[model samples]
Target chain A: MLTTIVILLYICVVLFDFLPSKETRSTKERVIYCILLTVSFCVLILYSLDIKVPGPTEPIRNVIETLFKPSK
Target chain B: MQKEMISARQMFCIIIMFIFGSSVIMGVSSGAAQDSWMSLLLAAVFTVPMLLIYARIIKLFPEKNLFEIIEMLFGKIAGNIIIILMVWYSLHLCALVLRNFSEYIQIVSMPETPQLPIMIAMILVVVYMAKSGIETMGKWSIAMLSAVFLVVIITILFSLNKMDFTNILPFMENDFKSIAAGAFRLYAFPFAETVLFLCLADAMKKKDSPRKLYLYALLFSTVVLLLVILRNLFMMGPGMVGASYFASYVAVKLIDVADFFARIEGFISMNFILAGIIKITVCLMAAAKGTARLFGINNYRKLLLPVSLLAVALSAIVYKNVMEMIDFLRFYTYYAVPFQVIIPLTVWIAAEIRMHKRKLA
Candidate 1:
C-alpha cells in the first residue's frame, strides 16, 4: 500500500537524516553505506507491500503481530 | 528566579488533559457508551479529594519525589520495596499506553508493519522528549491542549447536523453495580492518574497554586472529554459506540461535507500525533523519575532509553492482539484502583498523621 511505503520512506529519511555530515566520510565509504541503506529500505518496502519478502520475513511478521495486535 | 519552572495551574491543566487524553478519545467511549461523559464527571468529584491529598503530600515533601517520601517514611529497605513496586507499575503503565497508541495506528494505518517497530519508534520519541526535560514537555502539552480543544470544537460543530438527544436517553438504566463499575474506570483513568503530575509539580512556576486553578483545569479538560464522548454517542449511538474500539474516529468518519471529501477520521489521526506522544512521554517521564529515585541516580533522563526499550519489549510481549489488551483493561480496572487511588491517599494520610504527632510534641 502507498501508505505503508510512505511511512517506511519517512523512517528512512528520518534515520539517514541523523547521519553525520558527508564531509566526514570518504566518498567510496558513503557510496557503500548508501547502497546498503537503499537495499534495506527496498527490502522493507517490498515486505510492507506484501510482495513475498524474501529473507526470513514470516518470523518477523509473526513476532510483530504477536506483540501489537488489537484483537488480542 | 523561578523556583519551580512551571505553575501548578499549567501543570494541572497539562496533567488533566494529557493524563488520559488518548484513552478518552479512543477507548473510553467504546466501553462506557452514552454515560461515558457522566462517568467522567463522576470521576472528577471522586478524584479531587485524591488530588488534594496528593497536593498535601507534595506540600510536606517540598522537592522530594514519591519514592524518596516512601524511603523517608518507611526507611531504606521498605522504601526500596515500595519504589520497586511503583517502578513495576510505571513500566507496565508505559507498555499499556504504548500498546494503545500502536493499536490506534494499526487500526488506522500501517496494518502490516507490525506493532513492535511502531511501539519502539514511539518509545524512542518519548525518550527524546523526556531527555529535553519538563519545561519542553509542558510547552508541548500547552500546544496540544489547544489542538485538542480546537479539534473538539470542530467535531462538535461539524457533527451538529447529526446530533440526537435520544442517544443519551435512558440514563442509569442498570443497577448500582454497573454504573459504579463504569464510574470507577472513569475515575481510574484521566482523573486518578493525575498522581503522575506530582512529579512535575515541583517544577511549577508558582509555589502556591490555588484550588480554583485546579477546578478550572478539571472543568476545562472534563468538558472537552465529555463533549468528545457525547459526540461519539450521538453519532454512533450507544450500542455501536460501546462495541467499537475507536468510537471517536468512527464519529468523525460519520461527517461528510458537501457530498465530497468524506471520512473526516484523519482529524483523529492528527489528534493522535499530539495526544499519543503526550501519553507516552508522561508515562516515560514518570517511570524514569521513579527509576532514578530508586537507584539514587541524580539524573532521571539518563535512564530513559533503558526504561523505554524495556517498555517496548514488554509491550511487544504483553498481548497477542487487541482483544487481550481490552480484556486486560476490563479486569485491570479493579487492579488499577489501588495503585491510582489507595496508595496515594494512604501516603497523604500518613504524612498528615506524622505532621499531627510532630505538632503535639
Candidate 2:
C-alpha cells in the first residue's frame, strides 16, 4: 500500500512538474532532474517496503566520537 | 533574469523565525537544566564572532549567494565539491527537522499513525514555499512571526500562576565545563544554523547592511529564546524539564486558569508548524539552489520537488524512533562544527584576501 502511494506521488511529480518544462530545460538540466528523481523514487520505495536503508547518522556519530570524545 | 530581493525588515523577520524553528519546541540548551538560560546567553555570545564572519562574507560579495561566491573564489572543481558538501548539509538539516516534527506529532497527537505520511504532508508545503522564492518566504515570515510571538506571550502569561520561580535557584550549579558544553550544543544546533542564511543573502537588497541585519536578528532571537527557557524552567521545574523531550509543550500543558481555559498545548504545536515551515523552506531552498549550482541549472525551482522528495525519504529513515532522534542531538554539535564554523571561516579569510589583492591591483 505504501509503495503504491510512493509510486503515485512520483508519477504526479514527474508528469506535472518535470515533463511540462522539458522544452525550456537544457539537456543537462533534464538529465540531472531525472537522475535526482530516480534516486528519490528508489529510496522511497525501499522505505515503503520496510527494508532497512542505512542512514548517515551512525557514520557521522562514529566519526565525531573518534575525533572528539565528549567529556560529559 | 531579475534578482529576487527582500527588504531588511523581511530578512530580519525571516531570520528570527528560522532561529525559533525547532529550538522553540525542542527546548535548547537543556543540558544545563535550570541554568539553561545562562547556557543560552553564553551560546549567543560565542556566536557573535562567527556571525560577524558570516556577515562579512556577504558584505564582501554584495549580490552573490554562497554558492556563487564559492565558485567565484575557488573556481569550478573545488568549488563544486564544497557546494556538494553544503548541499548535503542543507538536505540533512532539512530531514532532521522534518523528523523532529513528525516525531513530535506522532508521539503527542497521533500515536497510531506512521511518520511517513506526516513527513510527506509537511514537505509538500515546504516545497511550495521554497518554490515561491525567498520574497514570498520573507512576506510569510512577517505575517506568521506576529502570531508566534503572540502565542508565546499568551502561554507565558497564562502559565505564570503555575511557575515556581525557585526552580531556577543556585546559579551556575552545573560548573563552567558543563555550561560551556551546553552552550556549545545550543550554538551548533540553532544559533550557528543561521549560516544557512548566507545561501539566501543574494535576496537582500544592496542598500541593506548584512552585519547589522545579522547582529539584530541574533539579538532579537536570543532574547526570545531566553524568555522561552525561563518560562519552561519556571513552569515545569528543572526535574520535569530535564525529563521531558518536548519541554516547552510539556511545560505549557500544565497551564490551568480557573479550569475553564486548559490544554492549550496545541498553541505550541501551532508555533512549531509556523516556525518549522520557515526552517524547512529555508533549508530546502538552500539545498535546491546548491543542487542547481552543482548541475549548472539556472532555475532552482525545478529541482525543489526532487530535492524535497529525497529529503522526505531521508527523514523517514533517519532514525529508528524518537529516542535515536534525541540521541543524535548529543553527537550533532560535534558533527556540525566543520560545516558551521570551519567552512565559513575559511571562505571569509579567502574572500578577504582576494578583496585585498583586487584593491592592490
- Each candidate's number of clashing pairs is 12, 0
Residues B159-277, model 1: lDDT tens digits: 88877879988887655556656777777766666676655555644355534556666677677777777888888788888777777888888887667747777877787767777
Per-residue lDDT of candidate 2, residues B230-304 (tens digit): 999999878888888899999899999999889999999999999999999999999998998888888888889
DockQ of each: 0.04, 0.76
lDDT of each: 0.67, 0.91
Q: Tens-digit lDDT track for model 1 on A27-71?
A: 654454455345545544554464553332234335545654422
Q: Which candidate is the best by lDDT?
A: 2
Error of 2 at B12 (Å): 0.4
